[model samples]
Every structure is written in C-alpha cells, then in structure tokens.
Target: MISRLLLFGATGDLAGRFLLPALARLSADGRVPDGLQVVGSAHQDWDDRTFRSHVATRLQQHAGDVPIEARDALISRLRYRAVDLEAAGSVAAAVGAFDDGGDAVDRPAVAVYLALPPVLFPAVLGALGGADLPVGSRIAVEKPFGTDLTSAVALNELLTRVTGGVEEAAFRVDHFLGMPKVQALLDRHAPGRPLTPVWNSASIAQVDVLWEETLGLGGRADFYDRTGAVRDVMQNHMLQVLTLVAMEPPARQTEGELHAAKLELLRSVRVCSAAEVPFRTRRARYAAGTLAEPGATGGRAVPGYSDEDGVDPARGTETYAELLLELDTPRWTGTRFVLRTGKALGTARKGVALHFRTAAPACDPGDAERVAADRLWIELDAPLESRQPGVQVTAPGERAAYGQVLTDLLSGGSRLSVSGEEAEQAWRIVDPVLQAWARNAVPLLEYPAGGAGPPPLEQTAGSARG
Candidate 1:
C-alpha cells in the first residue's frame, strides 16, 4: 500500500533533528517506497518551494552525507501546508487537498503523525476525527503521552475516538524501543538460554536501567524545567525497558503477542506506598562543580541546574532521579528494579544491567572471598557492544533509532510503538512518586554537576527491599 505521512509540527526541532533526517536515511537506503509521499504541516505560512528548501537544509545538516539522487528523491515527494492544528477546519482542509478523485480503495493510506506537544494531542486527534480520514489510516504520537495517569487515560480515549476503537492503528512512538541492542536483549530472553534460566527473583539480585548524560540542559531549559528527568525519561523510556526485561516470553515475536505480554507485565508492577516513597526514591539537582578525571590534568567545570538560563530555582526541578520498583509476580517478587537517569554527570552511561545473585559459598575455606555477581550489560549508546563476561553480541548495521521507528510506522508495524494501555500504565506506576515530590515528602538532594549521583540508599539485610 502507498503510504502518505502527514507530519504535524513539521517545522519544529523534533522534525528537523530526528523525523526528517530519519526519512532521508530511509530514502537513501531505498526503504521508503517509491509511491510514498511526505506532507509537512505547521503554523508557518510557507509555500511548497520554501518548505522543500527548509527540508533540504535540515536533511543536509542532520542526515549527514546523503547521496544526491536519494536526497532529491525524498525532497521531490515532500509537500507542505500551513494549518493551526488545534483549529476545527484546519486539519480537514489540509487533508482535503490530498484527496484524489478515485475511490478510497484506490487512494494511498494516510498516516497522521502528531509531532506536537502532548497538550495539543486532544485537539489534533479531535480535528482528525472531524476530517473524516480513511477508516484504516494510522495515527502516530510522540512521547510523554500525557502529564499523568488521568491525562493519559483521556489521551487514549481521544485516540479511540479517532481510530474507531482500533487500538493497533494508534502508534505511540518510544524511540528507545527501536534501538537494535534493545531488540537483541529481548531476543536473549527467548526460551532456553543462560539468561532465560535465571530470569527471576531467585537468581537475580537487582536490575538497573540507567541513562546518564554529561551535557547539561543546552537550550531546552524551558522545556526541561517543566519536565524534569523523571517525566522526560523514567515514565516512558526506562519503564519500557523494565517491561521488556521483566515480561514473560510472548507466544511469538509478533507485535500483538509482544504488546500483550508487556501489558500483562506492567499490570503486575508494584510501586512503593506513600510511606515507602521516601526510602525507595531519590531526586537530586546538580550543583556547579568540576568533573575531576582520574588521570587528566584539569577537570571540566559546569553550571548547576539552578544556574541554567531559563531554569527556575523555586520550581525545585531535579536533574537527576532514581526510583526503586518491583514486579509483584512470583518470578520477580524480591527483585529490585532500579530506574535511574540524570544530566550533567561525570560520564555518559546509557544501558540496562542485570546483576545476578552470587551463588552460595563453597565448602572450601579458601573460597570465602566474596565473588561479585555476574553482570549482563546492554550498552545502548555504543554500537555493537552489548556484552557479558565472556559472551558478546554485536548488532551490525544498526539503523538510527528514529529511522527504525519510521520504518516500522511506514510498514504498518507496531512492535516498537508504545500502546495506549502501556502509556497509561507507565504514568500510573510513577504517579505516587510524582505526588510525593510535589508535597516535598522526598527531599530533593543536591549533587555536584560531575559527581556520581546522590549517596546510595541504605540496603537492609537479605535483599534491598524498596
């Protein structure tokens, strides 16, 4: 089927940095079908020529070294229209122009991609419902689906209204799931493997899903201030990773099977109670400090979170957040799943680490020395470098995360997309933590900009119960 992608917020930073560049790479690789058209829409009043020029510039800047022929091929299929996405008639008018005289059966399948803010999703979806698009047309939404559980449920309701209750047609894009290494990790969890055998509370000690960035909030101060580290990362990306690790093996690898398994896993998630929130969660804002390297001469100095240009000190936003969660299932009851993310750290570390429990000591007295638990690391930022002690799985020719996501959407695949239920459940899991932070029940600790996060939480005997 011919696919036409309608990108809302076409002129925004996300489109320029990720969506358009990904499309360009797809065009270069000949993954985008010949008949597929890309139509960009925004509030900017630009004609087709001007819009094409803008796309060309962004592609050159972000895509990097696209062949001339491939670049032109993608640019040729590009079209643009100016529309106030929230207005009643705006979406209908834009879609109406693309309508062919032929019957709906003969026309291309339209996919409306909402790249706008989460706040505008309801209006855009409502406008699309009024536009009377094809019955089978798809809808793709960006991340941070909603601010909280209530809003997420409302967003899902809005999506159902537009898609006529067809949940599969709605695609909520979470770019982290599209990473090849993440897919590799899922493959390892299939039936009958070394890791699969120990994938339970009995064998595993703890699971850490960490995403740390050395760079501070560069120019995204306004958005970052409102959406601290938790909402921006833990709610969607980190939770999705947790589900993948803790979920039961799907009957098959199909999108439906995987999604169902993930939903079931999320349903079993147990968040800390109000009293336990303080001990189970930690939030910290970075303070101005120098990043001291072990061997390097002088460390790099950085500004604190409060020192950032657009940040508000009074808002008490945290640049770093850590939460301890548990799956209330028999397989993972005692296993602590720690989700951590921070900015302006000493180093950049992005991956999922599964730390296995050390076996019982041998009878020999010489073997009394404690042996560290085996660790399985999935290094996301580094390409083709996922490794255990002796085993390493290299994912060759891994495509860009956004590029893979675009490919999935264009081909009518939802495996990498977040379902409506998943989005809501993620917010539900973190709702209590958010409320606790709001009430100042959990103290917002301060850490040096380039230090190793806040002090570790005291672990009680037996296991670290959060």
Candidate 2:
C-alpha cells in the first residue's frame, strides 16, 4: 500500500482530467488501500478547503459517474499546500509533513508524482533530493520525458543521482502501455500459437500503427505549437506501442523481462538518413473545413491549424505526421512499419494492424488469382475495449489506462513505465526526421480538417495490407 502520495501539479490540466478521476475509480473499485493520505502541492495559492472544493468540482466534471461515497472518501484524504517547487526549503517543508512523530521507522512509503511540465523536471527533482524523504520512496514522472536525446540523458542522470541510482525507484509513466487491450494483446500472443510462427517478414507483408483523433487542440495551443505531432505522440506513445507489436516474446511476463525485450527491439529500429527522409516521411497541417457527423442537419465548421488561439502562423506546426520505418533485425529486414497520427481527422482510427502475405493463386480455372492479405487487427478504441481475431472480448475486472498505471505505481510494478535507455533510443530513431523538418528539407503539405490522410500510397502487393 502507498502510505502517502505527494502530487506536485495538483491544479494542472493533467490532474483534473486524468489523475484525480483515475484515483476516484480506484477508490470506487476498492483498489486503493485504506488510510492512504494524499497531499496536493501547486504554485496556486489555495488552502485545504479551497483545494477540496476544486477537487470536488473537477471530480464532478471529469468523473461524474463515480459513486458519491468513493469521491467523498478520496476527498477526505486530500490536503493542500502552495509551494514554489524550485525553492528547496519550501519543498522540504511540504515533505516533512509525512513524519507523524519524527520517528523514521514509523513513516510510510511515499510516492512523489510530478505532474508539471517537462521543462521543470530537473528543478523539482533537485528540490526532492534535498528533502528528507522516507525509505522505500518512489518518484513517478509523466510523459515527454525530455525534448530530445541530450535532455533525456541529462534528466535520467539527474533522476539516478537524486534517487540514489536505484533505477526501479523512478517510474516513467506512459498510460498507453497500461491499457487493458494492450495487455490482452500480450496475453493472446503467448508462445505456441499459429500466428506466433508467422510473426516475421517471411509471412507478414507490412504493419500499420495508427492513432487519429477527431478533436483538435482543445486549449493547449502553447504546448502543441511548440511540440508538433511527432514529438507529442510519435516519440513516446506510438513508439512504445510499436515496440510492443514488434518485440520478441519475453522469457516471462515479469516487468524486467518485458522491458528488456522492448528495449532490445527499440535498439534495432532504423531511422531514415537525411537524404532518405523526404521520400520515407510525410507531414501535413489541417486547414479549415466542415466535419460531417452522421444524421446531423449540418456539418460543424472547424478552424484551420494556423487559426488556433495562441498558435503562431510562422511555426509551421503539423497536425498530421506519417513515417515509414524499417527494422534492421534479420527477422524483419524486408518488412515496413508505418507509424501515423493526426488531429482533426474524419474518423478516429486507433490500433495496430498486421497484414500477412497472400496465399498462392488457386489451381481451379474459375478461382481468382489473387486475394486480399489476411489481417490480425488489435483495436484500442478506448481503455476497456478489446478486439482480437475479429472477435470482441470483454474480460471482467478490466481497468482504465490511468487506473492501471496507478495500480502499478502503488504496487511497485514497472511494466507500464518506460526506462531511460528506451527513452533515449526512441529519440535517436526520430532525431533525423526532426532535423530534416527544421531545415525545410521536406515540404509541409496541407489537408482539409476532416479528410482521409494524403491519398493512400500506391498499393503494391506489399502496400495493400494497411
């Protein structure tokens, strides 16, 4: 059981939209342990009652479906303190409250969660290093670990130094990995299966990993403008999903074994050279257009990417990105993996699809010579949904992605956490594309707000799979 949870950005969008709702669900399901105290710290000036009122309001807005008893119980454990996280003395004071009677042995295991922006990670960690933390304390950090490879390395080094070089004590969260559908895919693809034998270039023609959202930037223009689609989605979430789909089966399902397998797969990923990037990747920004809904009288008009509030027209931010990558490993030499994501799309298509090679032509005179390749699609429309082998499976006790992440954090599991090495390798794989785009080596195309992405690539026997 996690004795205490110190939330650094308790008043941020992430906290209100995701973290608090997840904690409420855990409470409703009896997953959170009894007597778990939660402390909220932020730069905002608010007392306990004000903070509780804020939590109550946000809880109703985001998690209205949760039971009143669960919400009330969660609120009862919450307390607030406003602190400048950069100030060592302020952080120390907030952390010192964990001590009930100044008895070191009696203190509970504390988990510090940093929900702030990535730029402030180092300052927060530095302050925590000076604070008198309890034994068995863990630190959980949200995604976009760093902007690039160099910063990611520096952040990892700082985390290790502060946490006494105990890698397991640092949790790098990626909620996509915690989705039950992802776990279900891992469970279905265990050893000794018909598909397992054909999970290679010899039998598979191509793979597509896509995440398209119909909604545009809600109110995050400042963040989204700086970090475009590639860094925002491809580097962390999409790469992690690709690793899962392409990784070799783990020796066992333990966290260590699974992470090792994923790390190895990432290490084998090949980035396009500067000269090859133009042909292998595509970037586009959405223009103003109408988004048609089924049975609606009229379509809803949406603004262009450049027209979004707080967005600079000169930045050339992309709303849609697609990259064609190849794995250098012998097992996947000839196969291609397409990674794509976009906002303000016509439809929300999110999942991984594996297209296998077609069978040889039939011998019968009347039979068709060629047929569509067989596909094994794993749908990840939402947290609890799962579809495998064309059949939907609803497993009991399925939890939301954020809830699973919390369960792992409180229970000392790192399966959903990305390691330092994995973070660096992911950046390495995309750094070239980033550089190319900055130099304007590749053209930035424009597409309507609601439309299928750039016309599908000419369908070769190989490209027909996606």
> How accurate locally, in lDDT, is each candidate?
0.80, 0.80
Candidate 1 lDDT, tens digit per residue, 1-466? 4378889999998898788888888888878876887889999999999999998898887666778778788889989989988797988877765787666566667888888877788888899988878656889998888889998998889889888898878989998888866766666667865456777888777888988876567678878898899999999989998888889888788888899989999999987789888888889999998754444457557688899798899999988988888888988988888888998777777787777776522222321122343666667656332222212222322337888888888788898799888898898899999999999999999998778878755342223362
Tell me the spans in candidate 1 whose CA falls farther than 4 Å from its real position.
102-106, 291-300, 359-373, 383-399, 458-466
Q: What is the per-residue lDDT of model 2 for residues 63-93, given as tens digits with 9 covering 90 to 100? A: 8889999999999999998999889998877
In each prediction, how many residue pairs overlap at the backbone (N, C-alpha, C within less than 3 A)?
0, 0
Model 1 residue 347 distance off true place after TM-score fit, in angstroms:
1.3
How far residue 322's Cα lies from its native spot in candidate 1, in Å, is 0.7
Q: Which residue pairs clash within candidate 1?
A: none
lDDT of 2 at 114: 94
lDDT score for residue 8 of model 2 = 89
Worst 10 residues of 1 by lDDT: 360-369
Q: Report residue 248 deviation for candidate 1 (angstroms).
A: 1.1
TM-score of each: 0.89, 0.90
**Clashes in candidate 1: how many?**
0
Worst 10 residues of 2 by lDDT: 385-394
